[model samples]
Target: MKAGREKARGAWQLSLPLMLMITAASVGPGVARADAQDLPIPCANFEITYAAKPGEVIAPTDIETNKDSFWVFENSGGNLACGGTGPFTCAGLTVTVPEKDVVHPSTAKTTINGTAAALGEQDQFSLTSIDANDVTQTCKGTYLFHVSSNGGGWGDPHLTTVDGLHYDFQSAGEFTALRDDRLEIQTRQTAVPTAKIPITNEHTGIKHCVAVYTALATRVGSSRVTLQPNPNVEESRKGMELRVNGKLVTLTDSGITLKASSGEQGASIGPAAVGGIDGHIKKAADGAIEIVDARGTQVVVTPQFWNGPNVWYLNLKVYQTSATQGTMGIVPEGSWIPALPDGSSLGPKPESIDERYEQLYEKFADAWRVTDATSLFDYASGTNTATFTLDEWPYNSPESCDVPGQTPVQPTTEAVAQAACAAVQDPKEKADCVFDVMITGHEGFGKSYQIMQAFKPIGTGTWYSPEARPTKPPTHQGGWVELLKKWWWLILLLIVGLLLLLRKKK
Candidate 1:
């Protein structure tokens, strides 16, 4: 029995391919009808001419010809594309004759009256209304009709009804119906700053939720709501609220809670949160209180309105209690705001940010005058008597330190020493100027030798001078060339000779 069954199955399989071949041969060659192969293309027909003035309707001449001879009548059922017999199908009926070339006419003459005075493809339209299914409201106005295709599928001439609503799309074969509401209400779906609390509030120490609202319009109701901190000041907090269908309702306190009414009926569990309600019904996580009416159910007593701040105490108990409203429930909370930018914990303060600017300025000026960096040293009275010298170390941008008669230039060491010696009457002051300029300007230029020969004598008060010179010599160690070149060389030699006698005896 098994061998026989296998043999029978193999025979059936062999016959399958032959059956398909027989069917194809019977169909015949080139039997496809032109009408079947080329289906009827849907075309839109409308009055293309319009009145020059507004609020006026213009009639157009008949477009009957070989091209528009056959047309499937339009009805509530939709455009019918049935006629002729062949592989090429004809849908919505089309004119076999070609349309007149209106753009680039042979001559500029007015032959057809009210038949598109302007030269172009049909650029005019006729007004009509769409009343069927979910589209009930009577649409009143002119509809601009055009034909478009998405390559894979071809659509009939579509009529665009120009209603005021921007969000609603008015076209044929659309899943969504055109809304009758004003465009402002349809497209103006802003967040409105009022919604449920944010989901992250629980983690940030916010224990409460609050909401407030104020209705602005009648049919087009508008409201403002707010969420605020609850009574628990020690804990962190966050909150938000929302408005539905022009109805104001805010969530506050412990945040939002959701619960299901029945098992298997479907439900959700999540935190109470706030976000933009772009014209849709919102409900509690447990499937309660949809802000948007997607179920098409009538709602009695829209959710409570809230604006400003409110507090809420959220928990399992609150979720169960809120389910009774058939929608979401809300509460009001409040919080404190700051009066100024800085805290006053430090006590009453001065009027300005910097109260000691004036005192600081005075101290800076006094210190600058007393301590002069320019001048020369003197030995008399073992003190320096010289003013600051800029000659030896002139100002880089001399204009910075140049007085009325001073020229801007780099100061020579000799000029600086001379200026230092001339400025102060005290030998020590003069020496200090030379030392300061040399160290600061020349990177210790001749400073060591100047200090040993000039400053050391004045500092010890051993070598005295009858009068301090207007300028002082270099405070560094005296060199042989310098001693031979100036009168100071003879004095130095005498002092050395006198000290030799004492040294020999020792």
Candidate 2:
């Protein structure tokens, strides 16, 4: 009896720990681990000093230094420079010239540290000077300089004098090494006491001008750099051209505007004029340009450019929540008619559809592609009474759905269904037709099914599927499999309790 009691005690002790572990696992806090790539890389800060030519010194009052002004750069493999060697090349140094200053208006410069570093063809750098009258003059040149390991020393000078003002700029800064292939250098004016530079505007004939200037630099390729005026301080004007992916896009005071390749006015997207409405454009994950308007309308434009004899056209797909309210019709290449303020057309009447059945079928197919049941139903007639089966249909082969280089299989069954609808003789009967469509190849499965649906014409060019307009609640299929799936946990608990009871009896 003593030995049996000891054995039972041991079994209970082991089961307690196991049960505790299971309980803990089921009820413990859930913490999600983030991907290493998603974590931000840490960065270090450093100070920088600048030396200006004797007469080109800035004022001390305008100079402000803080944590925000510190240069930020990423380190590559724990090295200060990208390649982890001596003499790294920094490119694309953009300088912003302050307004109300008679001295330096704006300047851009590039610096090379190593002798082997070469500038690429795309690198652009320049310096501009504005006189008392606001007249502007620019000089283009390259500046080469170096700093010691301790961040002290003035290197060679690239000097330029414009309108009796001697302009010379030199820089020295401490480099902070980072984990990624990047480094940050912070530099302040050493010789100059302040940040404000006094200048005269030659264009406006204004004197005693104190202008503000800001500078930033970005590395390009291995050695080449292109510099420009600071965009934060300068306001984007009506005619500013922004180069995006080798194409020149215009920026206006209102918003960004895109022009067609044929020089025609394209789409102008900006903040919505209506209250409680907003509109914006963004790049999609698939590399398509998507524009969303205030009314919840979306227009997706493909990156593929269609170059014609005169202009370039982009493939566009427009979507709206309401089919009747926001319907888009395809217009011919050059048949755009300007509408007057009083609702009068200024050009030829709208083109008439010769193949009405084909047009209706296309609309139906489009609605099906997007899984818009309401829109699909709106294309049928009111009197036609039939049930329509709404289910997922594979429009492409599994191998070619997302794979490159393979053409996707089209939904030929939809075409076959449309052709059957078009074969009706009487116009009235054709407008109100019934179709039994059988579709196969769903998600690469060869399963085929049929759906009996009736369509009726609501208006001259409008049709709707009557199956969607049900007067009563639809019936649903239910069985033991579904009930077991929902209550599986209860059955599992019962089995566990039974096993524990049997073990205790033993």
Candidate 3:
């Protein structure tokens, strides 16, 4: 390869501009750029060190609010590229609207100020990479930035709804997370015993507690799947509880097609078959089952194991086209979304959590609570959604220290818990991680946050950017893509030689 490149160096006098464009289609900035520099060229291996998935992004932050340089660098790979290095030369960037529906462009009028270009068009906003793990480059494909910035809190339950509304409602019940005309998501929230987890500040004399989601159900284009906990099963058991339509099914690998099981046919829920949902009943490599409907509703449920039983927590990362109505859709205390019962809007957000509680719990939580008609859960012969609701529930979570007249208290092992969550980067996530560890005295909870940071957040179009890009660090990629990159100059040399041979024959 070195000899070939050395040989091509002499022929470099030809059209070099077109060559770079032909070979620049790669993932991220780690791949060093190629260029013809001074005298005899020294040996250089151009490999993609950092590669972000096609439309992968995390932060919904825009160029203006974020003063960060190099907002988004889109390149028509194969048309031209190269920025992670090699003589760094290229054409320009193109902004693509990921899909239909969902607002376009993150900001009202995106006017990028950096050397990078201003966001040209809309549907999908061009914004900064939210996730710290994303590798910025001038040639990586389109970065995700929902104008309404759709995705929000799977925050273990400190809900951040559609329009970025933040609040908490820990009522133990099966509630609607999201409900559109066709797409639907339901979560089973179970209150944690104060004795089990100490979310209340140390012995502050308040029976403070919180709830975590134990199961999640989704109906996407004629498919209904429930991810729930396997009760009475030992912790050693390693598998997910997946109920397709109404009957339970065991999965060995990723994808599965559901057929009418005994008693599932003609049941209350729709038909018993998995109707062409992409990745239906498919288990992700990380032990989570991911399901997506044709019309852009997506659900990824990660299994959680702790003191009680091995339950699961789900995160919905979509803002549908239709009027989304449910817990996840309602933006409480914020004027962004039409949250009021009368089809009006909630004004600016209040400062304190208690103030939010007064609004979120009273208005949205109760308003969106699932009824017998709207309820989508499997019930025992004698029980129903009422089993989860409180006979006389309070305004705010009783476990919250934010309750008026009650002073907040920190756990006795605050230091230890903080230390456990020290590795988590995001401030809010870190704080939550520390508290979870301190309250439960279980380090596993905090570790989960650390693991999630690596996940490429799901964005518009219900398309997922694979969390791990290179799978193996930019090590020796033996595939043809790498082969071409390594011997590109050699290939060019042969082409030039062939051209010369044709000219001589002529």
Candidate 4:
């Protein structure tokens, strides 16, 4: 970019006339007429920057007049182009030039000192720019300019000013009196704006609005359930209980109780219950809940927003712990989807109500249940060489699936397996539960071990079948016994009477 300064043949033709007019109107003793020599190049300054996303903006600041002279520079990367749209525009000092060479003059109407300024019909203004993001290209585009003039002020670029550069810049890089002096300006290309990530909740029937704050406390869905600010009685009062899967939970001042599971409210279960964590439990003072596993690991939950009634944002976290360490991770919230009351659903089928849990169970159950080296590798969220073997079957049967891991303190395998199976109605679901029960024994083992077992590995010497086959018939079937026959003579007489009546009728 060069300084907008150069003498033209018509410099005097344009300036001389202006100078004569100024002198004729002037009564000063020794004031000289304006001339190229009288007024040196206007020193100016420029600023530039870029924002690469929609709703993002970049504008130059600290603008100085001709005192600071230079073009604001910006680098446009390959495949990138830069220009202002909407409220954004290229603005600077205004300069006047002949209507014939004014470079894409804008026909925008405006009032100067309460008088409408008429735009000339001649195509005087011109603007150009090179494109370099793609294949070989140079400045080859032109755009119209929003032109305006004041007694001696900035020439406001109207909203209509599009892409490309405006040349007719005054000595001060602004719109001012132009006296036939040629000006050349150039602008480097820059990146265009793109879209941004949206924030939303994924667990429940609540909508959360994201805002900037000094600090944000959040949890991943993999962490244990944590409630903030012990559910304020008032706030919690308005809160309806919902199953983790969004089943309608009946609410009471005591706490949200699972409606489907009577008396199993958050308040009903002991702190040790795994699935029934007190979601509304809060910190003593901070109003945050920190659910820690036996390994002293904290659970972090993600908020699942409910789009139904647009209630409060709900977050959930699950924690897995070992003797030495525990870990937590975020559960991603799905795109905004409608949520219905517990047991009910938003989709066409009621079965879709537990869609997430069902989907996740299917996706992870196989990996979680396989306890061999290969199974571990298949589902391992991390790398560990540990292997697992069941001594006497830690998990109760599927029916009592909620029973915790056996450590001289839990129920039998049959009980837990029964519980798990009871939770589902489908044969496939029961099979999955049975499978889960078997894998629980092999849990830390690598998948290779599982493959070695022919994928039919047995646990605790107990044979758990997806379908229970009856071994023998019931010997104690205690219903009503049959009676012996005793009415032979009466039956014979009834038959004889029936025959005689048929013969008489014939």
Model 4 C-alpha RMSD vs. true structure (Å) is 42.3
> Candidate 1, TM-score vs. the true structure?
0.14
How much lDDT does each candidate structure score? 0.21, 0.23, 0.46, 0.21
Q: How many backbone clashes does every candidate have?
A: 101, 53, 14, 88
lDDT of 4 by residue, 314-380 (tens): 2222222111100011111331121111212223222342453332222222222322331211112
Which candidate wins on TM-score? 3
Worst 10 residues of 4 by lDDT: 151-160
lDDT of 1 by residue, 1-506 (tens): 66655555565566455445444433322311111112111122211111121111223222221111122122233222222321111211121211223342222111112211111111111112222122222221111111111000000101111211011111111111111111011110101111222111111122111111111111111211112122243331333223323233554432221222222211121111122111122334321222211111111111221121222211100100101100011101120111111211122323442332221112211221112231111112333212221121111112233233422223336466555445444454344335333322322222222222231101110111111111221212346433443544454455455445444444
Candidate 2: worst 10 consecutive residues by lDDT? 148-157
Per-residue CA lDDT of model 2 for 1-506, tens digit only, reads 66656666676676565555455434422211111112111111111112122122222212111111111122232323222222233222222212333343222111222121111101111122223345432311111111101011010111111111111122111111000011111111111111122122221121111101111111111111111111322332221222322334433333322212221111111111212212334454333344433222333333221111111112223332111111122112232321222223224322342232222223222221222321111112331112222111111111222212322222225455445455555342222221112121111111000111111111111111101121211112334433444555664576567557656665
Q: At residue 72, what lDDT does model 1 achieve?
A: 19
Better structure of 2 and 3 per lDDT: 3
Instruction: Tell me which of candidates 1 and 4 scores higher on TM-score.
Output: 4
Model 2 misplacement above 4 A: 1-286, 289-299, 303-315, 319-343, 348-478, 499-506
In model 1, what is the error at residue 357, expressed in angstroms?
49
Model 4 regions lying over 4 Å from their true place: 1-75, 79-356, 363-506
What lDDT is reached at residue 68 by model 3?
A: 20
* TM-score of candidate 2 on Cα atoms, chains taken together: 0.17
Worst 10 residues of 3 by lDDT: 34-43
